[model samples]
Target: MFTTIHRWGNSQAVRLPKGILETASLRENDRVEITAEYDRIIIRKATKKHLTIEERFEGYNGDYRCKEADTGGPVGNEEW
Candidate 1:
């Protein structure tokens, strides 16, 4: 449960254990929010910006028509 902080290029980094990362639900390249609370360092998973249904459909501007054409309006007694 102990690790030594080392310098990575220009910044210092601490290698987290796989168990700790799994417990925290973290993965490689995942973003984290780091903050200093008085004397303690808090590291939390950053909230992902997920697009809603409306937002996903925002780019669509035209009506999507099917390939099949209507069969000349209903002629038989098709029960409205």
Candidate 2:
């Protein structure tokens, strides 16, 4: 679809159509890439950033599972 760039005070802006945004599954404030081709400009969604192990640990509480050791000796051992 063709869109026009209009003047916005000192900078320029483009009014993206709702249908186009919906078809692309884009949300407000989402990251986008603008590529300048020889004749036209291409806008595409940027790849999502993957979280690392350290990043995933941020604000994480210490919740873990542990097995208790057997207090008694061998099960087949004779009692004194």
Candidate 3:
């Protein structure tokens, strides 16, 4: 899709087409995650973050591999 950047209050904003907005299911005031990867920029829905380990494993099942010594422990030290 193509769009021209227009002024929005103080910062400039791009007008997204209805199709694009629908496809992304974005609504006004909704949060969208933005990040730069390699030569491209990516935008997607923002995910909820769990602060405590218990919060992170709230609904986890065998879908995760926990340390044998620590059943509630994360499989790896990687960030969720």
Kindly report which residue stretches of model 3 are placed more than 4 angstroms away from their true locations once superposed. Answer: 49-80
- Which model scores highest in lDDT? 1
- The alpha-carbon lDDT assigned to residue 33 of candidate 3 equals 88
Residue 37 of model 2, lDDT score: 91
Backbone clash pairs for candidate 2 read none
What's the true lDDT of residue 17 in model 2?
92
Give a tens-digit lDDT track for model 2, residues 1-80: 78889999999999989998999999899888889999977888988676799998998789877889878875665655
RMSD of each: 15.4, 15.1, 11.3
Candidate 3: tens digits of C-alpha lDDT, residues 23-77: 8898777778888899977878778653698877778775756665745745777
Best by TM-score: 1
Point out the higher-scoring one by lDDT: 1 or 3. Answer: 1
What is the lDDT ranking, best to worst?
Answer: 1, 2, 3
Estimated TM-score per prediction? 0.57, 0.53, 0.48
Candidate lDDT (C-alpha), each: 0.88, 0.87, 0.76
Worst 10 residues of 1 by lDDT: 70-79
Error of 3 at 79 (Å): 39
**In lDDT terms, how accurate is model 1?**
0.88
